[model samples]
Target: MKIFRRLLSYLEPYRIFLIVSLGAATISTLVALGPPYLVKLLIDQVLIQKNLPLLNYIILGLIALYLLHSGLTTLRIIYVNKVQQGLIFDLRNEVHHHLQRLSLSYFEKRQSGRITSRVINDVETLQAIVSSGAVIFTIALVTLLGSLIILMRLNLKLTLLAMIPMPAITFLVVMFSKKAHRRYRQMRRRLADINAILQENILGIQVTKSFRREKLREEKFIHKGEGYYQANMSVIRIWSVFFPLIMFASALGTVIVLYYGGREVIAGNLSIGGLVAFVSYLGLFYAPINQLNEVNNIFQHGRAAGERIFEVVDTIPEKEKKKAIIPPSFLKGKVEFDKVSFTYEKGKKQKEVLHQVSFTANPGDLIAFVGASGSGKSTIVSLLPRFYEINSGSIRIDGYNVKDFKLGYLRENIGMVLQEPFLFDGTVIQNILFGRPGASKEEVVKAAKIANAHNFIRQLPEDYETEVGERGVKLSVGEKQRITIARVMLKNPPILILDEATSSVDSEAEILIQEALEYLMKGKTSFVIAHRLSTIRNATRILVVLEGKIVEEGTHQELLEKESVYSHFYQMQFKENGKIIAI
Candidate 1:
């Protein structure tokens, strides 16, 4: 009940539409009562008297009543649709906006499909109730109540007898309600599971085909489809029985009314027309009772959907402290890490990925980190951006604690070029302008030239206006890498972090990218993580990380002289390649 009411609250903004719709519906239902009563008068008065003038008048009156009913109904439908569409828009927008504010860890723990279902499918279910089910329920309720009052006025004893079987019908509905709600909730979860599997398969279609796992993927989808099938069958099983029982109960009421009312008419205590009207009223009454049952079904479905929607709305988003400071517009680009440590939270447990790791880079210094995979090198740079908070100690930019700086302001001054470059589905110019939204076309072209991407972009079928397919799949790995470098060049932040940025390109492209990087790194504090030792030969300082700790720190020649971890790494690479080219 609470969830139902909360869902209705979304209608508050569209209350005027609600009011206009329901008012038209109520007036139309009242107008419906006139037809049966007119039928009674036509039978009892006009037909018996054989009055031609009164018959024509009655025909005309009935036409006018029907026209009025149709007009009011049209008004009701138009406004109801307005209210429904408005609610859907508001709810979906709010849910999507909240998703944008969530932390990266939140997405890491859940599938994209499950979250998408809450925003699309679940919200759609709630809208069904408001659009059709709720409106019909309201009309049925009013018709049922109005019919009862008229039935009693015509003959109270008959009305009382007809209502005797109603309590049993009510009991059946009450008993089914709890079970139906539970089943619908289960069905919603099953649907979400099916959606999850479908989305995963679609996203990984290439992998499945390459590994010859199409049959296996089909079997997996079928397994989930069976679960959804079972869930639906469970609801159908109970519904098939419940509906029949309700109809049987309604049939009993009609039987008793006919038995007694027929006897009264035979005795001349009730008129033929009055008894006919009473029977017609019974149909109106019992028909709405059936519709109310359908309303119950819709209500159960909506309540289940509402619970899922609110679950997302209630989740805590990334938080910012009240007193967080905004960093200066122009930063000096000095970075310091003092005894920093971090652990990645896996459910309730934490696995430390970095331990007492410390480093410092002065203004305009280029620092490089070389380590094996999973050695916590990326975690160190990620901490500087506050992507993940440190467990102990502090990291400062310039002289301010990183935590003290406002998240948006701090990140705005830092640029990153990741290993896998991601480009949205758009034109090349649009992707480049993403770095600085307000940058001029000339500036964008300049940045592209600096990153050595201008020549190829100009040669494309549409030049800068060419569409790059999803994740830049339309471009080669080298072309995509250069485009990303252009984006960062446009951003031109004082602090830059390049994580295996040039690793995907060929040797010739690597030289071009390195030249671009050297230009981008000038007069900036740069952090580079690389496995190719030749690229970082002139690094201001090279830190060799091992097992979540910095094991060696020195310049290239100094590290080679140490005859330790860095020296062994150099020796192996040099042997594998036959020689190390001096940069």
Candidate 2:
């Protein structure tokens, strides 16, 4: 109920439309009751009494009543649809906005499919509750109460007898409701699992095809599909048993009315027309009960979906402190990390990934980090942008702590070119412009030239407008890297972090990308995490990271003179290839 109420609060903006829709629904339901009364009037006054003069008027009245009902029903649908669509638009935007504010650690612990399901599929399920379910339930309640009053006025004794089976029906409905709620929740979870599996398979299709694991992937998807099938079947099983019992209960009420009312008519205590009207009204009463049962089914399904959606909406978003400062412009690229420590918490265990690490870089300095895998090289740079908050010490940019600056301003001034560059499904021009949306076309072209991407882009069929498929899959790795570098160059941030930016490209592509990086790093304070000894040979200071601590720091040649961890890594790379690595 709390979840449902929170969902309803989203409708506050469209309250006027909601009120109009409910009013239309109520009037339509009331008009619907007129038919039962009209039938009684026809039997008693026109047909049985043989009053030919009034027949035409009664028939015209009936037609007008139906027309009014149809008009109100149409209006009800339009207004309800407006309210439903408006609420969904607001809720989806809010959920997406919250997702953008979440830290990277949140994504690391969950599957992409599950998050996508909450954003898309689960929100879609809410249409039933918001659009039709609540309004229909209201209409059904009004119809049921109106029918009951009309039934009693026709014959109190018959009405009393007709309601005898209702208590048992109510008990049965309660049992079904409980079972349906649990089953629907289970079904939603299974659906999320299926979505997760499908998403994973689609994203990793290249790996699957490379390893020739098509059959294995198919089998895994089928396994997930089978679980979804069983969950749906469980709900179907409940409906199969519960609906028939409800129908039987409704039938028993009609039978009671017939048997008792037939005897009364023969006894001359009840008029024949009255008995007929009573039977029609009895059907009307049970109709709402059935509708209510169906509404309950819709409500249960929505409740399950709501739980999943609110789980995300209610999560604590990444904090943006109210008092945080926004830098007037980009910093001068001076970065200092003072005795910083960080621990990653996985479940109940805490593993410290970075020890007391410290480093500093002046403006126009190229600082390179060389370390084995999992030695906290990437973690150190990630902290510079405050992607993850440091545990112990202050990371200062210029003179202010990184935490003191507004998150957006801090990140906007730091450009990053990751090892795996991600591009949206768009044209080359669109991807480059993503760095700075306000950049002019001439600026984009100039940035591409600086990254050595302008020639290849011009060679493409559409020039700059050529589409880069999902994650830039249509382009080669080198092409994707150069475009990303172009994107950063356009942003022109004062501080740059390159995470093995050219590690995955071929030899020829690497040379082109290296040249591009040299241009990008010309005047910025740059942090380079590299495995290739040749790439960082000219770095102003080389920081040899070993076991989450900087064991050595100096210019490349100065570190080599000490024969420390830096020299050992340099020897491993160049001596293995039988080449004297230039420094």
Give per-model TM-scores.
Answer: 0.94, 0.95
lDDT of 1 by residue, 1-583 (tens): 8887887788999999999999999899989988888888888888876777888888999999999999999999999999999999999998898888787777988899888888999999988889778788889999999999999998999999999998999998987787899999999999998899999999999999999999999999999999999999998898898988998999899999999999999999998889999999998999998888888989898889999988888788766667987557699999999999888793456677898998899999989988878888898998888887678999999989988887888888899998888888999999999899999999999999999999999999889999896844389777888888899899999999999887777888888888888888889999998766565687999988888999889998898897777788677675577332221
Per-candidate RMSD, Å: 2.7, 2.3
lDDT of 1: 0.88
Worst 10 residues of 1 by lDDT: 574-583
Overall lDDT per candidate, in order of appearance: 0.88, 0.88
Compute the lDDT for candidate 2.
Answer: 0.88
Q: What would the per-residue lDDT of candidate 2 be over residues 1-583, giving only the tens digit for each residue?
A: 8878887788889999999999999999999999878888888898889998788887888999999999999999999999988878887888899898888988988999989888887888876797779798989999999999999888899999999989988998899999999999989888889899999999999999999999999999999889889999999999899988998999999998899899999999988889999999999999888889889899899999998888888888766778987676658988898999887673455777888888889999999987778788998999889887677888998988888888888888999999988888999999999899999999999999999999999998889999896744388999999999999999999999999898788889988999999999999999998766576788899887777888889998898798687677567766576322332
Give per-residue lDDT, candidate 2, residue 385: 90
Clashes of 1: 0
Worst 10 residues of 2 by lDDT: 574-583
